[model samples]
Target: MGIQYFSQVLIFGSFIGLLGWTITNQVGRTQLQVKSREDWLLDGTGLTIQGILIPLLQATLVYWLYQYLLPIQQGYLKLPLILAFVISFVVIDYLYYWNHRLLHTKLLWKVHQVHHTVTQMDVLGTSRNTLWTSLLIVYLWIHTLFLYLLADPTGYLLGVSLTSTLDLWRHSRLIIPANTKLYQFLSPWLILPQDHAWHHCCKIHNYNYGANLKIWDKLHGTYYKSKNMPSIIGIPSSLNLFQKLFFPFS
Candidate 1:
């Protein structure tokens, strides 16, 4: 199990590195500008202990509930390992689109603002978040439920883990070369740096709220395209760390 887990981690790390390298090499320089050191500390920094802990806590809690509380034994829900991976991936990403959109709503934006508050993009930026947002969000619950139902936690974890690699690439400060095969292959399906860069380009326009693919944004009218993109990204509010950390409530 350890070997398999380590191998998966290695693969994900390599993929992010490859994508990040392509991006950095192609973009000439990172378009994202750092506005303030205070801004960097407040939002730009990656997963703190709290950020990492919350996700793990939520995933584990949901998984354990399904294992012990749910009636899996009443009817066997065993899925072939391969099929489990496919089902988990499809359902999780599909649900993630809606989850991402709802997080932008008036009520939740206070919590989600901690993320968009970052003025620049980096791998760690993807991991930034509030603890309360993690357990309450539909997307995390979907992931936990899928893992518990399939009875193959390994595949479930593998599928969920793949998103981070893609996310890291999307938030990277690098740019994909216009001429690369990987660039061409990844452009249509995955949320590449350019896609997310456009998202952060505006506060209201070009939300581009898809986590994995463009299908949802295209299906809905939220998609925005343009010859110009914003040079800076962040919410309009001027909250400090303490305020942001306890936002929408505290």
Candidate 2:
């Protein structure tokens, strides 16, 4: 329970901090100014659903389901802290890489396309997606499974919190300068903002589907390295607000 509380605090604190930074920074302020009522509706709704409701639903449903199906296996896997963190951070991250890539495929694109409609790299747009899109995301299922199985999920929860925090950061305009030592250190392994910006690029949206690491994309040949942000981001969507929120299919 303490670990769970810590994870929640970490994730929420990062979000509030990012949001504060975005609102105060000049460029971020400019970007926020361009958001229309529709954009607000979509982004706000998405954030609420994904951040609050979906998590609650996942915890309730997955825990109950696991209780019935694997009662004896609850907290069965007792792993070392480092190994548990590695499983959540590295192993599950790789799985999500494919899961994210699969969302771009023809069949699932309709459900995922709403996320790509944001014209800018605003933190508010981080969770913008169809209300049901979380259901398709592998994290909703896999993360819960591991949490249920792990006897001590402290390290695993840490990874989950960090991943959630990074998700918010990557979608925002808060970028690291290419020439900086910090950028040099993190660029090789981590998927930085510029890397994710290209994924949202209007022209070449097929590449860079990894969530936390760039290695998955590099290994799968989906990585598109760039020191600069994309000139244009987000695909044009013709769907109405209702369609975007409920059924994003054309």
**Each candidate structure's count of clashing pairs:** 4, 0
lDDT of 2 at 73: 96
Cα TM-score per model: 0.78, 0.97
Instruction: Kindly list the per-residue Cα lDDT of model 2 for residues 210-246, writing each as its tens digit.
Output: 9999999999999999989998989998899989989
Please identify model 1 stretches exceeding 4 Å from their true place. Answer: 2-4, 11-46, 49-51, 71-75, 203-206, 226-230
Candidate 2 structure lDDT: 0.91
| Best TM-score among the predictions, by candidate number | 2
Residue clash pairs of candidate 2: none
Candidate 1 residue lDDT tens string, 147-232: 55654456656666666556666776566675789877877666677678777754542378887777678788777653233587
lDDT at position 48, candidate 2: 97
Which 10 consecutive residues of model 2 have the lowest summed lDDT?
A: 241-250
Best by lDDT: 2
- For residue 50, model 2's alpha carbon misses the true position, in angstroms, by 1.5
